[model samples]
Structure formats: C-alpha cells, structure tokens
Target: MTSSSKGSYTRLCIQVNLDKPLINTVKVGRLKQKVMYEGISFLCFYCGRLGHK
Candidate 1:
C-alpha cells in the first residue's frame, strides 16, 4: 500500500486476454477505480489481434 496526501492506495496488476472485452473500471463495495493499460503493444481494435492491423 502506498500513502499520499489524500489517502492510502493499493496497486493491482491483472493479466487479461486481449480477445475479450476490455475492462474500464473496477468496483469494490462503493469504491470504483478506473483501469489503465500499461506495457501493451501491437493491439488492433479492429480485429483484436497483435501485430496485424
């Protein structure tokens, strides 16, 4: 957990399949956090494949 001026937060790393629908946010009880993709490359939204746009 990391603490800042606002509050403490936990960072999460989840592995997901590129073929499935992308998740935008995660909700736990009443707290919802936006999901951001990092270190992802060669993704084509048109076909949901890598390196063949």
Candidate 2:
C-alpha cells in the first residue's frame, strides 16, 4: 500500500455542516495546540487548545 503525502494531511481538514442532515458514516476530530511561555506549558481537554477550555 502506498502512503499519502504529509501536505495532504494538513490540508484535509474536516468540518460538519449544520445546515445539512447528519450523516452516520462521517468522522470527526479535534483541533489543538499547546502554549508555552518561558518553558511553562498548559493542557486542555475541551477543544484541547491551551487554556481554551
């Protein structure tokens, strides 16, 4: 099997359209990033972004 390119991975972002009907076979994911200041970092569960929760 062949592997997909790394550029395609970041470009392929998923989003749900509320205006359309909900589909059963769809996949979902979360966006996240860690914030660091002077060697200190924070973590979050909801949405996973630092301090966004």
Q: Which candidate achieves the best lDDT against the true structure?
A: 1
- Return the number of clashes found in candidate 2: 0
Candidate 1 Cα lDDT to native: 0.69
- Tens-place lDDT per residue, model 2, 11-31, is 223553434533323243664
Question: lDDT per residue, candidate 1, 1-53, as tens digits?
Answer: 44655644656788778787566678979989876666768766556567753
Q: Against the true structure, what is each candidate's TM-score?
A: 0.50, 0.21
Which residue pairs come into collision in candidate 1? none
Query: How many pairs collide in each candidate, listed in order?
Result: 0, 0
